[model samples]
Target chain A: MFWSVTQSLLGGLLTTFQIFLFTLLFALPLGLILAFGSMTRFKPLRCLVQVLVWIIRGTPLMLQLIIIFYGPGLWLGHNIWSGNEAGRITATVVAFSINYACYFSVIFRGGIEGVPAGQREAGQVLGMTKSQIFFKVTLLQMVKRVVPPMSNEIITLVKDTSLARIIAAYELTFAGYSFMKSNGLTWPLFYTGVFYLLFVGILTLLFNHIERRLDYFR
Target chain B: MAILEVNDISKNFGSTTVLHKVSFSLEEGSALAIIGSSGSGKTTLLRCLNFLERPDNGSIVVRGETLFDASMPFKEQEKGLRTKRLHFGMVFQSFNLFPQYTALENVTLAEGLLAKEREDYKQNKKTICEQIEKHGRELLDQMGLADRMTHYPHQLSGGQQQRVAIARALALKPDILCFDEPTSALDPELTGEVLKVIRGLAEQRTTMIIVTHEMAFARDVSDKLIFMDDGVIVEQGDPKQVIDHPREERTRQFLTRYAQG
Candidate 1:
């Protein structure tokens, strides 16, 4: 009776939150680089990146999870992902990073290419160097353009972290379900929904505020 | 001696020969207009001066530095060409103002980049800001965009955006400024606004090379006018001669078609 729901759920929520932060850390910069590479003028380089993004986007995420978790040992005959919670978390991170990065790159590329070629020429006319043009001019506008779509992916990410359970990672969903099976506390699994809702709600409101700020673009 | 020297600059886009045996020069702080029908290689020649398009065969000497000297070889001359371009600024038919930035950021970003490379790199940020604000405020104000400083390009009117474009080019304080049909995108009403700004800049003795079809505008503003046709300079001289007393038959035909009463 003393096993209160708040404490039990809080532990699982902590794990869920960690995955969200870590995924963003690795994915944002990686996605931008991939976007730039895909837009490269060099034909072979563009083709290579396009094929990679296509395969990453076309395949199912769950399949990616299974492969990322299990493929290394089978393919290389070495268990690079050690047998522990660390390995499970590592595998989940890799799978999540790759899947989200591919999605993020498309948003990034669209934002950048949407910037008019005229703007770049204008920057050159002002004597801005290539890097200055990108960071100061192109990238700033790109962020505004990409935000709404990026927010969509981010909110989806809040839900996607639950997918980590497939690899036997003791993330929020796993912890909640464990209560259901062992103690027959079905309430805990349903309780997990509250955690997800709060996260998504907060992120959605944050994005809405950003959109309001960018309303000046109107 | 001419402050600028160009010898045999030629360019082709893949198979289409856009410019052939094109060459020109200018005196320091002199206003020269390159007037031509569309696709007559006028814009491309101006682009060569700015390194926006590398010429296939030519040598352009600005001040004393050789820019785009393809005669020496491509690889050896690329760096020198890019360096020379830092001394000149250009505006295009389209305003090309960065849609994401405010008017001030657009100007400051350029100075921050190109100025840092000069010997006076470690100068005070306050002075830099003062210079930018002084020129940027005056230009945008003169172009009638003082109220729209923080506005994005999309938020501004077409005429206002072109004013921002002019402000950006002037911010660089380059040795010369080039305009490629700068008013073509504007409505007749809006065209007057941008042209008026250019006229004011020209009155201040701002060195300029303009490519335009506005015959009166070109004739009135140009110290020298060049009529380029079929990728060659058909005629050029004082504006009164080229615009009024044309020497070449082609120049007369061109001027007559658009000559205003």
Candidate 2:
């Protein structure tokens, strides 16, 4: 029975890991684009992006997941995300990507702006085009500056993956909770913490390695 | 013909005028050193030539290419200004080297981009990379940073960083170079190292315009000198004549202050 529970929880952990990876894969680059939009010289676009980010960040991710999962079916009378495991996971990923992207964008904007204006001027005077300056000089320095904050958010995201259980996504937490409900067992539920701890522990090590590599900027 | 010409350039910030009808001409392979007190608009004049700061009214003609003309719509001038910026390299008071790039990468980054701008270079990636590496190394070697090329800006001393910045500027092979008090941010001991490099460039007769308070170096290295006070040129002539015998009272006062201080 214990072996079976372990096997079942591992299956759930796989789903959780999928959610975590997909969220980061979509959010990281989307956040950077939003960051540029937020700081763009074009007044209307900047304000529009800022407002959209404000709304996403102001609301709870759990609420966002519920709305995203059901809003299309309820409001439009069309079940875009059908009652299937893949559809549920897709909705969770979408809601999480949008939510985390807003937070990451704020960090990215701070990091980009934190680089001294003189550095851009230096690139310009050396005959670099604006895009070249942004990618070559500004972007790398911004990455170095943003890593610590970005790592913090990513760790929080790993734990937040449990929230996907609200949409019946069958992630690690849902698998653990099912055992308690069906078999009157609590230990397996507690075992879920181990999985999260291990995941976050490995992430911490990875981020530390990244920080060391970026240390040359300081 | 003059390598650079600034004709009646004027700038105003809000209501107060910062540069008033500033005019100057620089010959090829010559250095013009501008000296002045604080708020004298010397730096503004230098920045205007590179289009870093737009002059409200004037024309900047570099290598016979009209970079900025007040009559042209500001929007249309951006492309020309950017393309022409290749001909006017500038070194800032603070060594603004990209902190993430090593000295060698800092020197090569612009060269690689400028190369890629050409359609033929896009098809010859290996050849372009090799060419940029060779050119970058030569500039760093000239700046006496041969061994320091792999070091990041933060790892190097201020003097070394400034030298790397100079190499980064020179990698473009600009028609003229401009320095905005390049040694001002360095320690007294560090100042000599940067000034020595500038002196070397002067010996090679690189066309340059320097806004500086280093009266002694200005007299020693610059072919022409201009003393600016209160948004206008109070005096300008051969460096020795301007330094030794100032025609304007403002220039005399400024020189006396520098000499005593």
Candidate 3:
């Protein structure tokens, strides 16, 4: 009986992992582009990006998931996401990507701007173009500066994947909660915590390793 | 003909003029040292040559090509100025080596970019890389940093970082090299290491313009020296003549303090 319960949780963990992986793959680069947009000298672009980031960051992720999943269908008189399991998962991923991208953009903008202007000027005097200066001299230092904060957000994201349960997307927590209602097995609901703890523990190790690799800056 | 020429170049930051019609010329292999009190426009003049600080008026001619003309639109001049800057290498007071790059990488990164700009380099990419690597190693070796080639900037001393910066600048083989208070950031003992490398370059007759406070070193190393005060050149001529026999009251007052020290 215990074996079956563990097996079911592991299956749900796969979906959780999928959401986590896809969100990062999309969000990291999207965040960098948004960061550049926010820092542009062009006035309209800079203001538009800042306002968009502000709205996405101000709202709760769970509320965003609900609205993103159901709002389009209700407003347009058609189920844009098709009212299926795939549709529910797609909505969850879209909401997570948009939400995390905004947060990561703030972290990235801070990192990029925090680098000293002298470094960029040095690249300039070396006859490097502006883009070359950014990629060659500034990008590595920016990454080093942003890592600690970025890791905090990433670890939080692992736990927040359980919020996918709000939309009835079958992630790890949703699977565990279902066990409590059907078989009255409260153990699985608590057992889900172990999986989250293990995931976070591994992520902590990974981030620590990254920090060491970037230790040359100091 | 001179290797580099700045004709009546003037720079203004807001309403205040910093460099007022500053005109100077550098011979092919002569070293020119610019001396001045703080905020005397010494550093600003150096920056203007590299186009780091654009001059509001006057023209800059490098190797017979006019890079900047006050009469021209900035958009047209900026595109030309960037390409012209390749002929001049600038060393800063802060030793702005890319912190993430190793000593060798810092020296070679710009070399690779410069090579990419050459149409010939496209057909000979392997040869270009090999040449860059060989020349970069030679420059570091010349700076006495061969063993520390792989070391990052943070691991090096202020002197060592400045020396690496010198090697990086030299890797491009610029027609003229400009130094802006290169030893100001170093300790007294550390300053010697950087000064020694510069002395070697001077001995080899590398064309250089150094803005410095090392009065004795400037007297010994420079062929031509200019003393600047309050946005204008107060005195200029042979380094020893200007240092020993000042013609202007401001230049005499400035040199006496160095003499007393």
Candidate 4:
């Protein structure tokens, strides 16, 4: 039973890992750009971005995942993300990116804004251009400030990917539950906790190391 | 030509004017100490130099270049302001070092920015470490903060933080360095360490403008002094002439109230 559970869980683990990496690959950069949008000095752009963030953050992750994956087809009347493994993955990515992007945006906004206004002024006086000031002084500091909260979100994401099973994507947790349905083996369902525990443990260690490296900014 | 000139520069927040038709000029490489009571607009005048606060009237010319003009909007003058900012460095009372960055990162940021602007300016990225180490080391060494280079702002004392701020400002080798009440945040004992550092910079002939309340330090280090009151320069002259022997009654009264008791 344990052997069969391990095999099914491993397949689920593979799918889970891909979603996690792909989401971060797209989500991190998209979050930074959204952060800039929310921070834009132009009132219209800032207002528009803020409203979007309010919508995403104000809603539940479960509702968003269901709506984004299923809503597009119903609203567009095209069945765009059809029923298949690849299609499910695509929908999951879209939903996950939007939800995480909003969370990441708040973190990014706080980090960038938290950097003192004087540092940028000092940069300007030193003859650095606006872009230079951001990349050098502003962004460097923003990264350090954002890391703690960002790590929290990233670790949360490791668990959040399991939510993809809601749309029948066959992720780790789904694989564990499959054994109970097929052969009435509840142990396999409980064993899913191991996969989650290990992933979260690894992420905790990485974040701790990064915090140590930033000790200079204390 | 004066190295820097402020021609009738004024600024208002909403309807209340903080600076009004204020005009002044200073020579290259001179220490001009601006003294004033709270809300007297000393810092506002200094910020206008860097275009951090856009003036509502008139213009500021740096080294004979018209960086700001009320005739043009701030967006139109932004390029000139950008160019002008390259000519000076500002240190804040709060020691606004990028809190996430170490002292070394703060210093190299200036050099990196300049290198990026000059496109063909291929900097050997590998040597950047050595340069930061050398220059960052030297500036900190000069400010007596060599051991604290890797330390963060919150980790350092108020005086030490201000010293790092001064080091960060000088790292760019700017044509002018401005300080806004740099020692106000420090204790009296720590204040002297920062003042000593500034006096050393003055001795090195680094062009600077200091808005401060330390009357004795201002008198000792300033080559020229301007007393600002209610958004106007009420008095101006050599430190000895203006601070020691005031021509205006208000300046005299203000100095007597704050001067060493």
Share of reference contacts found in each model? 0.52, 0.88, 0.67, 0.83
lDDT string for model 3 (A100-128, tens) is 99999999999999998889888988888
Query: How many backbone clashes does every candidate have?
Result: 0, 0, 0, 1
The C-alpha lDDT values of all candidates are: 0.81, 0.91, 0.91, 0.85
Best by DockQ: 2
The regions of model 1 sitting more than 4 angstroms off are A1-3, A42-44, A75-78, A183-189, B80-82, B118-123, B138-156, B259-261
Summarize candidate 1's per-residue lDDT along A14-76 as a digit string, tens digits.
777888888889989889988988988998989988998999889988889999989988999
Ranking by TM-score: 2, 3, 4, 1
DockQ each candidate and list the results: 0.48, 0.74, 0.67, 0.55
Q: In candidate 4, what are the lDDT values of residues A1-218, reduced to their tens digit?
A: 68878998999998898889888888888888899999889999999989989998999887898998889788998767878977888888888888888889989999989987777777667776778778877886787889899999999999898899889998999999898899988888778988889988999999999888877665
lDDT order, best first, reads 3, 2, 4, 1
Best by TM-score: 2
TM-score of each: 0.90, 0.96, 0.95, 0.91
Q: Model 2, range A12-112, lDDT digits (tens) per residue?
A: 99989989999999999999999999999999999999999999999999999999999999999998997998899889999999999999999999999
Of 3 and 4, the candidate ranking higher by DockQ: 3
List residue ranges in candidate 2 displaced over 4 A.
Answer: B122-127
Q: How well is each residue in B120-221 modelled by candidate 1, as lDDT tens digits? A: 557675676577677777767777788887787787777887778778887777888889888888888888888888888889888889988888888898
Candidate 3: TM-score, chain B only: 0.96
Could you give the DockQ of candidate 3? Answer: 0.67
